[model samples]
Target: MSDVLQSAFNAFLEELKNSESLIRLTVSTLLLILVVAVSRFLLRRFIRRNIQSSEMRRRWLIQLRNILLIVLVLGLVVIWGHELRTFALSMVAIAVALVIATKELILCVSGALIKGGARSFNIGDRIQVKEFRGDVIDQNLLTTTILEVGPGRSMQQRSGRMVVLPNSLFASEAVINESYSQDFVLHTFSVPFLRQHEWRPAKQKLLELAQKHSEPYLEQAKRHFARLSYRTGLEQPVVEPRVTIQLQCAEELHLIVRLPTKEHDRNQTEQAILAELFADDDYLGDYLPRV
Candidate 1:
């Protein structure tokens, strides 16, 4: 068995020695790939060690990985430049026919390129394109899939459907990113009061309740807004949870409550606020009047 194995190894080495250029190129390509991969891994480790706590570190890591991959691709082209060009030229007619035959595939690939360049949305982002609305669960060069949420009354709840959308959709549709700046969104609901009732107390109490429930998300928004403003050159909007008294009609005084909430938690936060409203004596007896 040892003699047979030695013979086989010697024959393989002899074959490789006979094709010196091919062996060299093959080994060099593997080495280049390994070097690129190791550098990427080391860069990731360094970032994790030093900048793991940084807010924008994840974006930076992704960018660095892309740059390394691009460099590896260019390196391969330089190493096998002549052979690749000749092979590509020979296959040009066939490639053209394939592209035309796979029209949808080409469109999807182009759309993916456009989507990446446009920075339309990212994974875990809740987006609405056309009538499809959901959280992005997966994306590929050919398709972008979402976990479908909401159908009728259950607006925020998942509908147990995974929507597989072709990346091509972004070329012709508007994408509404619900929580682009932060993981939270401004959610508002109103409570009713009689016009004869003193409104200030209700407003004050609601604001307090909203602030209490919304404090964490507000803090997160503040951090995200710092980055968002720096990138977009847009002024930060007032994120302090507040209550506004709006007269919906002559017959009704609407105590409008607004707060920052996680996109998934908006309904629950609204329900909790509503439940707490009547729990307070001021909100319940606002219309009881002067006795």
Candidate 2:
């Protein structure tokens, strides 16, 4: 056992001689001891001269000693910073390799980070990504839950289904945040009709109906949009009602109506306009035909 101990001690001495980091650390420790001794001697002399009360002198001594210790520790850290950094980087690389082993989980985490960094959407905000459109109900690192909101964009009512989408999709897909405007938005819907020669009168009447329905909040929308434009440095968008004629095919015409309406009342406002337009025989019977 004594021979074994001697051999072990000899091995340790050999290692200590060869290890440059250990040698530097030992020298740095001795320097730190000298620095501490000098600092404490000066601190006691300064405190003795400045402080009148014994308790105050004691407190000063303690505080100065603590400061000296902290400085020594920080100096030691700075002296060995390169090694610490290398060790830290090695640990990080191992962690990254472990994370990449689970591809889906890493993707999900990456996507969550992307979403957070982008501030794309939040709880209760309506968003659309690819075929998925819904109000964000809950979100976690792995998945986002949305209360499904449509058979299509034209229909804005809830479908009473919950969709759990893997956050990974956000990395690949474009996200449309519908509630970004918060208060009001320009809502558009297509009104299809058979190709007719005299489409002007129907267009005029439809515009009039839209103007009537949206007249109540048109000024407010204009103000909001103006502020939004100023704050965002974007061009102020048209807030008034407008209609554009589009040729769906050789035999079909689509009258696209766009109007600014309150975000929450978008569907209701659109439904009201369509209901009124269809209920009137003059508007539907003479000009428009259902596709």
Candidate 3:
């Protein structure tokens, strides 16, 4: 048994010395694997030390490490192609064809990966990509699902349609996440009426309604903005209800109320505002836009 082991060991050494391809393959594999392992370890340590409280950033870092490993492995295989030039060239040609055929798919997947890694937006967040505005309902490798929203009585209400947007669009288009850093979005609605000398009572009445309707949101927004300001170092905007009068036309005036509210509650809030306004005064109810 010892003699057999010795003979096997001798044969292994002889092969190691004579087989250039075997040596290259073994050394390259070990070295490349070590590099990958070290890189991952260092990256994880760095993330742990520097990145705090962001699960998305941690996920992104891990994904980037995996991608680095894949690219490194592929490049190493290509580098060791001298021993099997024909096979390597054939594989390369096939890869090129596949890339060409699935270029859009590749781009879409890449976009998804990038978007996910960046934590660009999450489910239930209101986002706009180009002209499409909606709450992101689902997201995967190829597409994002949204409940569509548009301008109407309530400027931010859902349009009762589902839009499946390809992830590829994220690569070329801009993304605006309304609830990215804050839980509430600033909402605006205008009540237009003819300008008259006796408009003070109506104007004061509208301002009271704006404050009453937005009271719940006002307190919540202040707490949210305080944290957001500290985190982002941005100047915090006042979270109280604001009523600004704008001249719409020579004969008309606009009372635009800006308030912070949850995007999901905007439709209901608009309806509530209208109901109260109509109940309080018959004149403005006739002129207000129909819900």
lDDT of 3 by residue, 158-237 (tens): 78999999999898888988776546767778877786533556567767887888786688778888888889899997
**Which pairs clash inside model 1?**
none
Residue 250, model 1: Cα distance from true site in angstroms:
8.6
Query: What tens-digit string does per-residue lDDT give for candidate 1 at 1-291?
Result: 345445555655565567558867888899999999999999998888888557678887989989998999999998877656655554564556566778898888989998999999999888898889988999999999999877842366678999999988987788888768656677777777887766667788788889999886678876766777788999876778888878888977888887778767877898787678667465444356635
lDDT values, one for every candidate = 0.79, 0.84, 0.76
Clashing pairs in 2: none
Stretch of 10 with least lDDT, candidate 1: 282-291
Residue 207, candidate 2: alpha-carbon lDDT: 93
Residue 227's lDDT in candidate 1: 72
Higher-scoring candidate on TM-score, 1 or 2: 2
RMSD to the hidden true structure, all candidates: 19.7, 9.5, 17.4
RMSD to native, candidate 3 = 17.4
- lDDT of predicted model 3: 0.76
Query: Quick one: ranking by lDDT, best first?
Result: 2, 1, 3
Off by over 4 Å in 1: 1-101, 152-154, 189-205, 216-220, 244-256, 262-264, 278-291
The TM-score, computed over Cα atoms with residue i paired to residue i, of candidate 3 is: 0.60
